[model samples]
Target: MQDVIIVGGSFAGLTAAMQLGRARRKVTVFDTGLNRNRYADHAHNIFGHDGTPPGELLAAARQQVQAYPTVQLVPAKAQLVSGGPDDFRVTTTDGETVSGRRLILSYGIVDDFPAIPGFAQCWGKTVIHCPFCHGYEVAGTRWGLVYSSPMSLHGAVLYANWTDDITLFLDGHAIIDEERHKLEKRGVRLVDGKLRTISHDAGRIASVTMDDGTEIALEALYAHPRNRPSADLHEQLELDMGDTPTGTMIKAGDMQATSRPGIYVAGDLATGMHSVTFASNTGSLAAMGALQSMLV
Candidate 1:
């Protein structure tokens, strides 16, 4: 049996595997290669590697982890997780089953963008979710906020701090009266209409089309897309999930230990504010926790 089996070989999984391997622990990392930030052209605000493409960063992480002979990186989606405590069993998409003394779930979340024309095409470019990720590029530009949930307003308010040119689109969603008034008072232009589609040119969004056939020019847009966890196996594992501003994240303790004894969650699957740095840090913590438990 491996010392640890890490599901989802993204930033978090790779970091955890690196820590465990350096400590002379055998580790296996399973991944499907569907990282949430694949659409981003480049990642910002990461120290030492500012403006680096996310794919490149992950590639370098994988290379660094594999330098230790104890770590094995496998390309497969973990489909089933069973057993518990210091002993766990993981089955992957390829029907391969592996057992480990400890399990680290670095599985990320899936982003479900709005079903509007050009929305996905412009995502991570002219359209983004996190202000810290894409705010500086479009600072002071004609930015628009499309409301899909109550959190959309919060995103609008936050984006306004970065740019004076901000517009809020109700997008056929109900907004509370007090919230509407507050938004207007804060200089956020409130537009009441259904968004029919997004018009774009060659992956760059130009404007949003309303149901009334009116086009609102937008240099950039912000949205809060619904997020789903990377694995449905969490339900089978009987882990406690809690609602977050982004979506449901598996509730865990300080060491990334879930209520389930041997099952640990890391990265976006455990919490929101999904960033490379946080995920990597959590992964290392999870690995250290598992290592300490093994020693005991």
Candidate 2:
């Protein structure tokens, strides 16, 4: 049995593997190779590797983790998880079964893209989610906040720091007068209409078209779409879950330990703040938690 089996190979999974590998613990990482940031041209806000392509950073991490003989990275998806503490079993897509003393879930989440035309093409480019991640890059540009939920009101207010030219697209959601006044008080333009299409020039948004034939020019649009865990193992394992504005995540403690023993979670799967740095940090903490459990 391996010391640990991590079900994801992006930022969080790789970081967990590195921590275990450095301690000479046998660990295996199963990755489907689909990272959430794959569409992003470059990753920002990550120290020491700011502006680096997301793929490049992950490649470097894979290489670093491979230096230890105890670690192995497998390009496969985890199909199911079973067993219990110190004897967990993971079945992969390739008809193979791997057992480990601990399991780290960093499979990440899948963004539920809106059905609007050109939205997917512009995602991670002229369309974004986090202001801190891509805000500065489009500072002073015409910005639009496509409201997905009431939680998005917080995003509209936070975005004011990056640009004053902000428009909030209600997208079929009703807003109370109090909230409307609050947004308008901050110089944010409010538009109550369902988005019909996003017109972009080569994956860079130029404008958004509403169902009522209203067209609003935009340099960039921000949206927080609901997401679900990439892997379905959470249900099979019966791990405790919590809800985030974007999706349902595994509930982990300070050390990234899930309510279930021998299972830990990290990355976007465990928190609302989705960033490369936070993912890596949580992975490290999950490793420490797993190690502590094993040592005791």
Candidate 3:
């Protein structure tokens, strides 16, 4: 049996492998090759590697981790997880079973895109979620906030730091007087109507159209859609889950240890602050936790 089996080979998974690999711990990483930031053109806010393409960053990471003799990378999906500490069994989608002493779940979450024309097309470009990731480029440009929930109100205020020309699209949701006063105080324009379509030019948004034939010109749109874990192994393993403002995530402790022994979780699957740097940090911590467990 290997020392550990890490599912998902994106930022979190590769970082975890790097940690255990350095310690000469036998580790096998199963990756379906789907990363949450794959849609993004370039990753920002990541120190040292800012402005690099997500694919390029991960490619470099994969190459570096291969130097360790104990690390093995497999291009496959982990179908199911069973067994317990030091005796866990992982079955791949191809029907191959692998046994490991510990398991690290770094599979990121899947985004639930809105069913709006040009919305998906503009995603990762003109339409984005986090301002910290894409706000700088479009600073001082016309910005629109597509309200998904009350939680989005905070995003509207935050985006103001990048641009004062901000408009909040209610999208048929009723806004109370208090919320309206707060938004008005921030110099945010509130638009109330059902969104019909987003007109764009080559994946770049030009205007947001409402069902009532109202058109609002915009350069960029911000939205926070609900997401779920990329894989369903958590259900099979019966791991404890916690709710975040965005979606459900595995509950992990300070060491990235899940409620279930020998199972550690990292990345977007465990926290709401989704970023490449944070994911890498959690992956390192989870790997260290796994190593300590094995040593004990």
lDDT of each: 0.88, 0.93, 0.93
Model 2, CA-based lDDT: 0.93
- TM-scores for every candidate against the unseen true structure: 0.96, 0.99, 0.98
- Pick the winner on lDDT between candidates 1 and 3: 3
C-alpha positional error of residue 7 in candidate 1 after TM-score superposition, expressed in Å: 0.4
Which lDDT value does model 1 have at 296?
Answer: 82
| Candidate closest to the true structure, highest lDDT | 2
TM-score winner, 1 or 3? 3
In model 3, where do residues sit more than 4 Å from their true spots?
A: none
For residues 1-296, what per-residue lDDT tens digits would candidate 3 score against the true structure? 99999999899999999999999999999998889988889999999989999999999999999999999999999998999999999999899899999999999999998798888898899999888999999999999998888787888898889999999999888979999999999899999988889999888899999999999999999988889999998899999999988789999997899989999999999998999989999999999999999988
lDDT-superior candidate, 1 or 2: 2
Against the true structure, candidate 2 reaches a TM-score of 0.99
